[model samples]
Target: MKKFATITLMVFTLLIGCTPDANITSPDESTIKSQAQLIKLPALKSGLKIETNLTREKYINGYNGGSFIEQFEFQCVTGNVIINSQLNFPAGAFSGGKTITQTFNTETASLEFGPAMQFNIPVKYTLTVSGLDLTGINPETLDFVYVAQNGSITGVEYDSITMDVATGTLKVTNAKLNHFSRYGFVN
Candidate 1:
């Protein structure tokens, strides 16, 4: 009887220990170090994987020269995003008609050359649309262009790609950018 009671207590303790906690998660850590890897290439190839059904307007921006507004929409039959941009502006202040060479980076922002994509995010998501937009009326002031594409990863590695469809969206979060507080915004 004593040995049986001891064995029963051991079994009960083992069962209690094996019970899974309610808050256990798969991701051991959420934040990924930014310096893990850095890819710098002039451009990458693309094949228009998803036809982009998006329309946008009012893309007037800053800097001198004849100011023009650009608007574009694309439908992705199938391809990858294959564009590399580098924007550089003359150091120092800006004037009414200053000829600043704008490149892909913060500060002298442009519609095309915005922020770069950031990895090591808390969630597992590929950016549908992640970048900035420069549509400034004044040649000095720069507007922040932000984009977030729509895509929810539901399927797995070998299963059917039912959830990989690209029915994207463009939500304009009308806002401006400050160059000083740039590190918090861009790289």
Candidate 2:
């Protein structure tokens, strides 16, 4: 009986010690760190929304310069996404001599860029058009010049505009103020 009791106690101790707890987690911290790797592009948060009026402060050449209003928005979760753009004169401005208006709506979970390239962001997302409209008196022409096309990962004079689509990494380059044209609004 004494020997049997000792054996039973030993078996019970082994069973209690070997049991695995459901709440116990692994001590390896790298696994969590690897998963925590998030896209850190600062431009992603700089300003998702950009709205400004185009001014006649500068002109491309001898042609009549047209002003424009622009807006930009950005966001990223796993990857990077961006919209780079350039805008021409508003439509119907020449006829009415009034401010031409353009409205853009993005309903997707992605980002959007306006006439100003400064707000270009890198993020991973989808773009859905919620609404888009252009209205003005004379209705001047408008164009989106691709200084850096969408998904382009190189040669941006500004670091902020450059971003990694896979890793969601971002770099903010210097501001490029002189790249846009004025009188070219005709085209």
Candidate 3:
């Protein structure tokens, strides 16, 4: 399964690379933000099965902590188009904090922002998994990044989530570009 996922991501990246470098103007900030706001991400809907795992990290000074990874295997039937992607939870459950979702319409980019946390507080976050409804582009070529309130987190401001378009699984945790093959512009 791991090998298959690696191959699938490689293929997706190659597809993106093959696209001719056409002069495509990037969308404005306001436009992207507006589209992101217009779109609604339904709360993990009912009748859908969700699988989660909890991994613990033992701290030497008794600061031991853990992370909960939750994933949803479902389909988007309400929207005109359906995108398949996985959502990753870095911190854990959202018992308190804030959560926000943003999408770049023209670039077809979407992001989820979690609450801001201080030094003593641990934060929870949600990432757009495999399927993001980017209007026209195939879910396979869509890369993901989570932009959250800045403060005590390490790595890039936006967490890059990996999307295996073929298997419909999000493999990576933390913000790092998934790096995949481009499949060309959507018509």
Candidate 4:
């Protein structure tokens, strides 16, 4: 089982990262706030990877509303991320040929966006996929609908950042972010 993976979906740099409100404690705070704000944005939806093997035809009590049936295995993990946003799974959602799920082992559930420093402040969020259980379904005719009740974002840790847009260069010093504010963002 692979412990960590980052799947890039598209090339969205400026759209995802935020524009700060110039009222922070300092430049460092302003930058970190910008990076951490990604999770608060709807764009975070593009960064999740969930797949499952369970079908709606059966239940733990029984099959087709019967008296006795079986259940399948389940798993979800967290990596070096700052924190895994708790997502609520949708209710009574089902699709004929689609599934969504995620599996994790005995890990702290910290979704490390990447080395943590650069990942915390990302130009784009890459949504990698997890395992899938395709049984008796044709790949061509596969079609189903699924939704995650909640979503998540990667964690960040950068001591300081220095950028020179004129020359297209960014320098991160101290390399470890130890503070952040978990607040709401305004549109």
Candidate 5:
């Protein structure tokens, strides 16, 4: 019986040794080549003539004691020029039915949420700005800022920002919005 148990343990060890490690992965040559190509791509220049528009709208029935949580993605895309913005409204965000308007200004790289009002719960807003010239700008020095009506800017705390140099896309995630206003990225 001891001999049989030893053989079984040896077999289990061999099987474990033969199994591939899930945590370790090597990229294929094709994937490496594609990554190289992406690295070699030219930087997007300024004045690319990108157009913008509102691409989506969603309505939720949160009025009259109804509770709902909804997320809406609004995109302005034109031939690779994309301004994607997402708003996640928490449950019981509004006391009544409300219409929110979003506007993106490409020239200043700013976004405006109209009907400036505070919510019962904070709404999360994420923005990804693409198809703009980001040359000579360091992504690490960027911050999400609130642009006031008088053009004054203030840095908004508690937001995460990331940038892709290859695509010239800057993204701000988890920006909590208690009130609607103009927001944008700044260095």
Candidate 6:
């Protein structure tokens, strides 16, 4: 009888441990901090030019059912700024094989991911910018922004943003992207 009681108590404890907390709640839009700021890129001078780097139609197999990771580095046309970026797709994110493309617009400091489609699981975009002048700017206020094709700007919801003053690098980590669009950094 004592052994049976002990076994029942252990089962109850296991069930309670596996249960999720009822007090947990998702933050509403108002409770979430906004990371976007309205800004415009400076117009390029006649001597300056808009340069772009394109990675086209990289094929990834979906039949194998595995995570996919890709890395890209883009240099700004105007200055010494460099953006080291990565994209991570989890298993079963999509069906069948697909082609992915990325484009870096140097003049606007924006990145575009092609064949724009929504994902079942959020695609994580992590970006680190180097060689940028952060003088007089609050690094904490730096965040990623989404630029529309019509030039409308909006804030990107990011998991975290950090700055390394010594290395002159600002990193936007785990920015959840539902669909591909033009993304850039703003103060």
lDDT tens readout by residue for model 1, 1-187 = 9999999999998887667642244422112212111111112134434322221222212332132222332222232222222222222212233322212221222232223322121111111222222122222211122322321111111111111113221121212222211111111
- Give one clash count per candidate, in the order shown: 20, 22, 23, 22, 0, 0
Q: Against the true structure, whose TM-score is highest?
A: 6
Candidate 1 global CA lDDT score? 0.25
- lDDT comparing candidate 4 with the true structure: 0.23
lDDT for each candidate structure: 0.25, 0.29, 0.33, 0.23, 0.61, 0.64
Residue 106's lDDT in candidate 4: 17
TM-score for each predicted model, relative to the true structure? 0.22, 0.21, 0.29, 0.18, 0.60, 0.62
In model 5, which regions exceed 4 Å deviation?
Answer: 1-57, 61-79
Q: List the residue pairs that clash in candidate 5.
A: none
Model 5 Cα shift for residue 46 (angstroms):
13
Q: Give candidate 5's error at residue 15 in angstroms.
A: 72
lDDT of 4 by residue, 29-82 (tens): 334333332111111123455332222221211111111122222332221211
TM-score of 3: 0.29
> Highest lDDT: which candidate?
6
User: Model 5, poorest ten-residue lDDT window?
Assistant: 35-44
Residue 185, model 6, lDDT? 71
Model 5 scores a C-alpha lDDT of 0.61
Model 6 gets an lDDT of 0.64
lDDT at 40, model 3: 33
- Residue-level error in angstroms, candidate 5, position 186: 1.0
